[model samples]
Target: MRKRVTMCQWLSDKIDDEPEFLDNMWFSDEAHFLLSGHVNSKNNIFWGSTPPDHCLQRPLHSVKCTAWVAISTHGIIGPFWFEDDDERSLTVNTERYIQVLRKFWVALGRRRGIDRALQWFQQDGATPHTSDRSLEWLQQRFEDRLISRRCHPEWSPHSPDLNPPDFYLWGYLKDRVYEHNPQTIPDLKAAITAAIRAIPREECRRVIENFARRIQ
Candidate 1:
């Protein structure tokens, strides 16, 4: 709580110095969309006369995909999927993350007619996001526009509430996607894409605009 208060104070000071700070800010994060919708012991519940033994058997391999998404007051950037190299799932590395950023930048440029020099990019302290190679790539492209572990005005670690995508968008997306109850990987992907697209531009702007209030 102390750390959160301190971080909020720091953000408040920054916002006070620059009233337009949130306008240029972009938030990015990655989330896994599971085929089974993240069913866990605590949340999983069944009601029946008899114990459903067959339904209790867990799969040896759970099907899932990781998607990277970014949003700004202008609009959204992507639902970019992290490729699976082997049969097993893979974590995003610096190389893959950079590739995603390249695509995201192109899309962002096309949509907003803005360059990296004019924007502030915020990312969490994930290993791939903070790696030396990743930092170098971001520095070369975004320069001082970065907000990460090693960047100035660094984001508070483990503080997802400070990020709109984490605090609002992801949960909103997950709820909508699960409503479709997709049965396959492609279906899940389609659902996620559709849900993101369906989000109103005004709502997105409202969330981004509320950043100042959140910090206060």
Candidate 2:
């Protein structure tokens, strides 16, 4: 772990080209760093991430979750947590996802909204985005805003250098909730939201920027 940590710092430094370049890249490009989805459930509400053994058992539960995340390279996008289920319901989770995505242009308004003008967004080619409904929704929502998309999860996989949530967010979650066990789903859910909120925004931004420099 120490070696990995050192290597991560080295890589982070080189990829970024400078100490602050990492953060600048995010704010400058308006890129969105993404990753494989996170799992949330009733019976098993542990923190951090699913252990390697339980990684791909989704089909069994059929519990729905959606592609609910957003980012600004500068900061977190609005968080829209949902089950990887269907698209029938317009719950806050789903609507929240849209709202967060929409806020980029509304707030940035052709100025900071590089995504709106260049039509570029970074994401994996998950089934949801490929689905007819989600595709149509994005088409209507962003129009020409989404330019080149990074589709294959493996290619870039995720920019460990520029994406800190991969390391920091889980660490924060585990640190706070692992001790709790969070016996109930609702309890776990509340704990997660609280943990997320507790993280200092500037700290998260620093970590996210540092990620751009981490080596594999």
- Highest-TM-score candidate: 1
Q: Judged by lDDT against the true structure, how good is candidate 2?
A: 0.42
* RMSD to the hidden true structure, all candidates: 4.8, 9.8
In model 1, the clashing pairs are none
Q: Worst lDDT window (10 residues) for model 1?
A: 37-46
Error of 2 at 49 (Å): 25
Let me know the TM-score candidate 2 reaches against the reference structure: 0.46
Model 2: how large is the Cα RMSD against the reference? 9.8
Candidate 1 off by > 4 Å = 1-6, 39-60, 85-89
User: How far out, in Å, is residue 15 in model 2?
Assistant: 11
lDDT string, candidate 1, 62-131, tens digits: 7987788998777787898887655344679888899888898888778745666778888989999999
Q: How close to the true structure is residue 80 of candidate 1, measured as C-alpha lDDT?
A: 89
Give the TM-score of each candidate: 0.84, 0.46
Q: Per-residue alpha-carbon lDDT of model 2 for 145-181, expressed as tens digits?
A: 3321222112132333333443455445546654665
